[model samples]
Target: MSVRTQESALRIALVFPGQGAQHPRMAAGLYGHEAVFTAAMDEALELLGADGERIRSAWLARTTTADFDDVTVSQPLLYAVDHALGRMVLDWGVEPVALMGHSVGELVAATLAGVVGFADGIRLMRARIRQFAQTPAGGMLAVAAGLGEVEDLLTGQVHLAAVNARRQLLLAGEREPLDRAAQALRERGIVCRDARARQAFHSPVVDEAVEASMPDWLATPLNRPRRTVYSAYTQGVLTDDTALDHRFWARQAAETVHFAPTLDRLLADHDCLLVEAGPGNSLSTVARRHPAVVRGGSEVAPLLPDGAQDDVRDRRSVAAAKERILPLQQPVRA
Candidate 1:
């Protein structure tokens, strides 16, 4: 295909990974190295108040102020990093056809799309922490098996949490029960790993907590997305009404995430250059398994290094992605 033909066929979609993608000091490489990203991230942290400062400290120091998956640190830091990266992408002059996010990343998508103000999004996350405080302590498990293969194992406390890709599934439950479930899956020769989660999100354990937090929202009217925003939770394009539904947001953690189905729908709409605009490359890793990407109908770019802190490498990755998306325009770096 000619350059023009290939460019014409491109439909860019910015995808953000959620909770489990967080690591100690994730995306530290880009903290002060990239101007646009640094400013946006700082703004996000500032809105988060004192807690944001603490999170920033840990992130920059490559240490943890609390459990890596604790709601206080992980959720806020992940949200800030993902949001900042999205802003950086927008600054590149490339318009995304859609914004999609997994789990908490969906809120980041919603914030960027104008469905909710950024501060309001942060408040909702805070409310989530407060409300879930009373719930039973729980966690999530990442399993390398299809839902159909493991659905029967979810008992009273255990439940299917998320469908990341074709065979990658997530299970959530109270800690003890989740551990038992993992053991059972292992006995059946299925690979399983504990997700970095301090709570059993997307499980019944948090249902009542979610219900109690439904009223926790500002009176500010929700806005329509400036661009298309696909929802992993609903597995469809998010409607304006759903965006305005506080109850819907409240029940998010008590429901399963249909990320794979949503990705299928997003891809069916058009082939895309799927960019991972968050810490690590988990979503990009998942997207690579999709048929269109494997068939060369789509491309994927992850902006940060996967396993370690490398400021220079991070800048190079962003610069590389910038070139891939906008060859004629020079990036802020390189």
Candidate 2:
């Protein structure tokens, strides 16, 4: 299952989603069906204690009132589910050649890549959730504009949180300013949608949180990734000179996620399958729509779809991965 083994026919790329993709009962299908997934979830729950129990209960209940959107719960839960799904994919015989994660999802990639151990990664995620929970209530808005247009809309109140695509931008800040910006954009006939986030993430609004969490992040040990890991912060492949220290994560918390550029890099350089190992196919859809992906001819697939039957989704994922790894046929003529 070592990603570096180099025996697999397909060059697989594992991609994870960040926050906002979480739902009330994500990964319910895989929980008991996949042993590796179950083991990973159990380990994470044991580490998380009561908080983990709450999340697990919500995820398992046939019906219940659970707030999956709370930052404190969502971040760690997403990490655990994503990590378990990646492990399940490995168990299915597809080894990743590289890994990429958007926003908080990077922690999962880091842990799987050996950049950080599972226990330590969970601790960091918990510390991060605590730090962010202290921030004043805020929200995020997605506007249909390019970077320059979005930047012009910033009035010392809001900051660009993510550049998802060529013209897709996310802004985060205090609720009032964000609402005002959204109204203004709509008045101009632009499409804007509320992201429904409880706090402003990946913006200057979280600067204080970033500063407060520095000591914990710095104290955590990290190592070079065993597999290639692209950084959404840098929008490029992580290098030896790139520091995975506290300063790096501090900046990550307060800076825009350059996801489009990072995807472009992966598409341009790697003949790999883009496998979204998360609850939804949103990132997979984004990757499929990218020009580089269309031009370069890389396959994009999701491990699961929203609200799909458990057995169907699992079967589809296995079929897709197996098809991708099949060797090219030899010339028929003798």
Candidate 3:
């Protein structure tokens, strides 16, 4: 495709993630290219009084998926990488018409959208990590040939976390009941597996944690966003500072994410270019499942000029896209 055509077709939507996407080396390439991103990461480490280098190296390390499963470490690191990448993309001048963050990734999305300052977002992440850390939680996995059937299977012990599609669902709660539910699904020939996550994030268990952290989160200042930021909690476009309330943040931790609802609402009016702004490719994978959306860039070195390539980790074919990164600008609007 020609550059002009590609650019014209770009109606970007910046999508942020919650958890389950992190690695030590996720954003190493952008360290030099996007210093502000690096600075944001450094600030995150400073908040914890830990070595940033060690943290980066830990994520970059090639290890089993289990190695990166700790909620405390994963949450902050995910934010760092996503925030860094989001800044790099904005610097590249690829403005999105809309922004949506999944779970914790919402903070990164809000930061990039100008809804919240970077530093404050990082601070909130730190507090959020601590607040939600104490609660005991676990995640569920199921591949449903039929999603409707599984709805009846959810018990009080387990709750739906994410709806990846009409056919895929994520359940969260205590471990034993979740395992039993998985076994039941398996009996039905549904593909169900346990997620690597230790915490049942986005469930009722985290309500107290979120509530304790709310006064502090709300105290964090709000800034005007560059683009419209939609909230999964509200399932609508966020237009005011009041959007960042206790109920919103609390529900983010305690409620199941109706991603389909949020995505459906956003895609209806906009020709969206969905950019998964984070370390791992989970959000991007989810976006690809939707026929209406397309990917922006990935993590490999020297992909897009102004460091856009490092801003996102494109799980697409790297072998075919080794061309030197190109400098880009906003295409003229129709």
Error of 2 at 130 (Å): 2.0
lDDT of 1 by residue, 1-334 (tens): 4463534466778999888888776777777877888898888777777677777776776555566677767877888889889888888887788899998889889888998888887777666667876788899999999978887888677999999998999999999999999999999999999998888888898889877776775444588788899998879999988888877776787899999999999998877889898888889999999998898878788877785676777788788888777752332211
- Candidate 3 lDDT over 250-295, as tens digits, reads 4677777777778768877676656666655566666666656533
Compute the lDDT of residue 221 as modeled in candidate 2.
Answer: 82
TM-scores of the candidates in the order shown: 0.93, 0.89, 0.82
Q: What lDDT score is found at residue 289 in candidate 1?
A: 90
lDDT of 3: 0.65
Compared with the true structure, what per-residue lDDT tens digits does model 2 show for residues 141-207?
8777887766667888888898888888789988899888888889878899987477898888889
Model 1 local distance difference test score? 0.82
lDDT of each: 0.82, 0.77, 0.65
RMSD of 1: 3.5
The TM-score of candidate 1 is: 0.93
As for model 3, its CA RMSD to the true structure in angstroms is: 5.0
- Decoy 3 TM-score against native: 0.82
